[model samples]
Target: MLKKDIHPEYGPCQVACACGNRFETRSTLKEIKVAVCSSCHPFYTGKRGAVVIEAGRVEKFQRKYAGTRFGKPAQETEEKEQG
Candidate 1:
């Protein structure tokens, strides 16, 4: 049994946010336009960029300890010492 007179009467059937987010929830009216759109979001825009390169870090380390006893094996150093 559907009663027309007993039904709720809500005005402005549609609601829209300034962020371009639109939704409908049984409003008595209808909205058609929104302001801001998610198309320009940082995540959606794919514009985030980050790059890093350690300039001369490896080269500096190598140059500073080119032929030193830092990483030489124990047997090689022992042979050199014996020789």
Candidate 2:
């Protein structure tokens, strides 16, 4: 037995995936956003590589510390080498 009024409302919901896949299903939430879904999942799609979105932080870090002892900057080492 279940209470009639205690349960949250469940109805048709729209699910959006980052890969531009959208589908309708019943859920407690009216809308759902997901990073990956069955339509674009690697296992389902048979893709071997994972999707990665970089925001330049890795490039910035490497540029900021290219070659040094524990990352002291590349210019100082270059100057030391030349001197």
Candidate 3:
């Protein structure tokens, strides 16, 4: 037998999305906030853009390591050998 009053109250809840979308649902929480939802999710909207906060990080890494052998640049290694 399940005990009464042991579990928290369950009732209708409201969900608020960051994209300004709100909906009603049933949850333990009275109000919930989320960063993304079906209304604004990239997959659902089919709009894929840069979601990273720090942009250009990937480009910067590739540029810094271009033409490199091991961790050192190929040109630097050749110069050291000649010296």
TM-scores, all models, native as reference: 0.30, 0.59, 0.59
Give the Å shift of residue 37 in candidate 3.
0.4
State the lDDT of candidate 3 residue by residue for 1-83, as single tens digits.
86998988889999998778899999889999887788877778887872533456778887888766656767889997899
Residues 33-75 of candidate 1: C-alpha lDDT, one tens digit per residue? 5443344334565655312132356778878897876667888
Better of 1 and 2 by TM-score: 2
The clash numbers for all candidates, in the given order, read: 4, 0, 0
Native-vs-model 2 lDDT? 0.80
lDDT of model 2 at residue 21?
88
* Candidate 3 ranges with C-alpha deviation above 4 Å: 50-83
Model 2: lowest-lDDT 10 consecutive positions:
48-57
lDDT of 2 by residue, 1-83 (tens): 98889999999999998889899999999999988888877788898565733335667887887765545667887789899
- The stretch of ten residues in a row with the least summed lDDT in candidate 1 is 47-56
In model 3, the worst 10-residue window by lDDT is 49-58
lDDT of each: 0.58, 0.80, 0.79
List candidate 1 stretches off by more than 4 Å: 1-52
Residue 55, candidate 3: Cα error in Å is: 9.7
lDDT of 2 at 14: 100
Per-residue lDDT, model 2, residue 16, is: 92
